[model samples]
Target: MVGDYQTLKNIIEQSLLTALFQPIYDTEQAQLYGYEALIRGPSNSPLHSPIALFDSAVEHGLLSELELICRQVSIETFAKLGLQGKLFLNVSPMVFLQDDHPKGATLSFLEQYGVAPEKVVIELSERYVVNDPELLAQALLYYRELGFKVAIDDLGSGYAGLKLWSEILPDFVKVDRHFISNIDKDSVKREFVKSILALGANINSKVILEGIETEQEFYQLQELGASLGQGYLLGRPELLPVKILPSVLTTHQRKVKYGNYLDKLASSVFQHAVSFDSQTKTGAIVDYFTQHKHLHSLPIVRDQIPVGMALREEVLELFASPYGRALHEKKPIIDMLSSQPVVVEADTKLDEVAKLVTSVHDEQLLWHFIITEQGRYIGIGSVRDLLKQLTEQQLQQASYANPLTQLPGNVPIYQKIDDLLTKQQAFHFAYFDLNNFKPFNDVYGYAKGDSVIRVLADILQSYCTAEDFIGHIGGDDFIAIFVSDNWQQKADSICQHFDQAIRSYYTQEDLNQGGIVSPSRSGELQKYPILSVAVAVVEPDVERCRSHHDIAELASSAKKEAKKRCKELGKSAVYLCQRRGPDGL
Candidate 1:
């Protein structure tokens, strides 16, 4: 056998590598999407597989060199071939900050091959242990400034995987193959995928489901809000002659992406036309409005406050209508126009707009809807124009929506949790369980069980106010959100209502017996206690929540404590679990 040193050097140098292109489809469009550049060495070569090659390289102190070669080749070849769409290239964190990186040369090569900086995605692999998080973060920042869109590869693969995400803030997150491989066979894996996907959304990161080899996985990932797909099912990688894959857009997804685009524009609504003081004359308003053709209307503000609106039509109508004849004499534009056309929050849903557009009530005759935050008019978005944008966003959301409850589901729930934690908002999170739901479902048919769940959801909805958030955690599990002050009260109310509504689904005999009278999984008669619930509440630390994996471990621990307490007390109607944090807290 060859000696370790020589063998390692040879493996690194002679890693006969080939490329495999896994398609990353548009989350909303369902098109062939783009491709993630994956590398595989010769079947017999020591450096044949990424795992083997990288492991051996690390052991031999050649990891940096091996990673460098891979980068050079992937960039050089893809840029030369003028590949369309995006190129996802995996880079090790250790190699990302190499002192002598050939970035200048790579950029020059890309220019020569007609590939722009935006077209290339640098996916930092989840392989090496990061010794200095600050160093990694700085490197990522530098690369992003240089026009390289960053990604974290194999997210949720190890202890350090989630940590890297906080440090790097990747543009894309590639879900590990292990989680994607058999999601159809395991509920646990599906939850894991949902959590990871949600984490990605919270960070505003795109997600690419890796190692998806079956149609089932593809559809499942789509349903989980994963817009990009990178796996064998779409198409395997090929050298040279790049063949374009077929479109993957579904009817529903196409509509949704359009909506999201609108929402994005709405976020920057403040950048549009300026609002005129309510005192401004019609002549002054017309001058400002004409200066910017993009402006559909002029907001009427009084004392730095927007309370009314003046539109192009309203101005023209002022000139034509009987009311206009009187204004024609002498009056300010504020006097001629109506009060601010019914304003809506910038974050309002497109569906809400759809309904408002068709409303016949005192719908405030208006040219546009003014979007505001905290009672301040920030931007004005036309209902007609934003409709298209809402369609697109919905498509993407639909891709990740859970089929069971039609709610945003587990993926969205994870995303919301991550967002709340990251924002460092002081809030309480309650993990809800249906207490003996399985036995109830088992005793009654799935249909009746579903009805009970729907009822539970209805009750939760009744209690959820604008500040409150609720999510379905899938299969007898639920989640509730509230600010610090009213969190416990909301949770108590939910439990009280849930206990009542859930019991109503049971038969008189079952309720009287105070236990489940049903066959077990093995068809044996079993009498388990009446259904009960346990909740685990916690205030998360944004910086430490890290990835879905970390947050989940915290939630899981809380849940276990709840379960243990329930068993110990021999009670089940409702129990408050422990609150966990650092030792001092």
Candidate 2:
């Protein structure tokens, strides 16, 4: 603290902090969503990292002063550069929102640069503990009323931010980088993103993911319905960032690509239905149900908001007893409404709907759920419809799966690689071939050949994580497209494991010689080594590669090279191609 004190003091006193803009992309729309203003101290100073600089500010009781300078510098530079799209200004709630802090400073600063309040997003940083929810909320509401939008920065960074989110419900949610970094390879992170996206959808808050430094991360975020992304892959922080969208990364429009109905949104099965206002008389609803016997249940609304669903059976039973009509004829329909109804937004994914339907204790509500748009009832859907679509989707996917190993076959494998290419994701393509499989099959018989294939399948499956695609390309050939960077180590591990595992398939006599005898094409007996797997790994420069066809051709060449390398190495080995793209070198 002694050595760093004067440097931090000098930076604060001199107002040496400058702002750099990092582009936040609208992944779905293929447009520039906005720039998150990142702050930096003097490059030569030890406080160059914003974390250290701000932490030093807090230690020196200059947090409020430092934040003010950062805000002013960020807002003014954003306007001076004429950077279009929203300007996200990160604010420490503890320092900036304190009651005694300068109230008109933001407006005055924006006015100096001629930047509109509407174009600025007041981002609340979640690094500080928010002891006063009311004060923090009042500050956000103040910004909202001042013609500025608000965003919760670093959501999931801590429990405080989570509570702040529920209380504030800002226009944007920038999820913490912790979950976004390796989401493609981590199922837990993927689930976390799924839940956050679902939460944002229900509340109509746009979800933004930060720290998407890889194409795999971006594709994973988009596939999970993330609306905004920010990281070095999109753009690094610059004094003046490029205004145009990155052509290669943002070229493809987001498509609804799913292997099955599990990923489909709930709106796919939407049907128009009538809803009753809560004030409507019970007798009137009963009369309407009687006239329309086909309608089993209907949603109840209050002032254009769905309150609950009303079942026809419950309403009819309420009136069937003697004197029941006189007892409840004039009562408002809200009284007999189901205590809790299954309600979903129009854009909620079908897979999510299925989870809610299956977990529910209410038998009727489980099947019949209300679908709403912006909290107003639009239609109703039944479980029967959801199940039918799911069944059809499963059967379709099953048809494409290989009957032998139950792994996805050629069609799905091709589609997977093509989709990654279309999304501009760079990945490793590993082609696997059983080196002596046919000879082993010839000598050991077909059943043993099948077991050998299954053994290879099991080995491949072991390497399958959330980020890699493993597919059976038929016969003795298979493929693995790895999104993670550690595929090289995995490729080595696969070869080494296969080298040892294949020996188990050889009979004692064959194992003794470490070879099998089979007839050659000309009918001469030939000796073949025990079955060994050969892997060819290709890292295509995605910019030059167009489709999976190009990848398949490259992989084929790599496979041939791997076979050559296997003969030279006298064991199973991975051949990594030095050449990239369709035409090697």
| Best candidate according to TM-score | 2
By summed lDDT, the worst window of 10 consecutive residues in model 2 runs over: 250-259
lDDT of each: 0.66, 0.82
What are the TM-scores, per candidate, against the unseen true structure?
0.40, 0.45
| Model 1 lDDT per residue over 1-585, tens place | 222567657655764567666667654544445667777766776656667767776677676777766766676677666666788877777765566655565566567666788888877765777777777778777778989898878877855668878777788888888998878778898888888878878888887888878877777776677777776666666676333332233323323422232235354333465788766667666656567766667777776557877777557656566675456635666677644376766666666765665562434453566777777867777665666666766666644453444445666667777787777776667777765677777778799988876666555554555466666767777777676587777666766666665667777887888777767789898887666667777666555555455556666767777666556654433344344343313
Q: Which stretches of candidate 2 lie over 4 Å from their true place?
A: 2-6, 96-99, 254-585
Candidate 1's TM-score reads 0.40
Candidate 1 least-lDDT 10 residues: 246-255
Q: By lDDT, who's the top model here?
A: 2
Q: Which stretches of candidate 1 lie over 4 Å from their true place?
A: 1-16, 42-44, 96-105, 108-112, 240-585
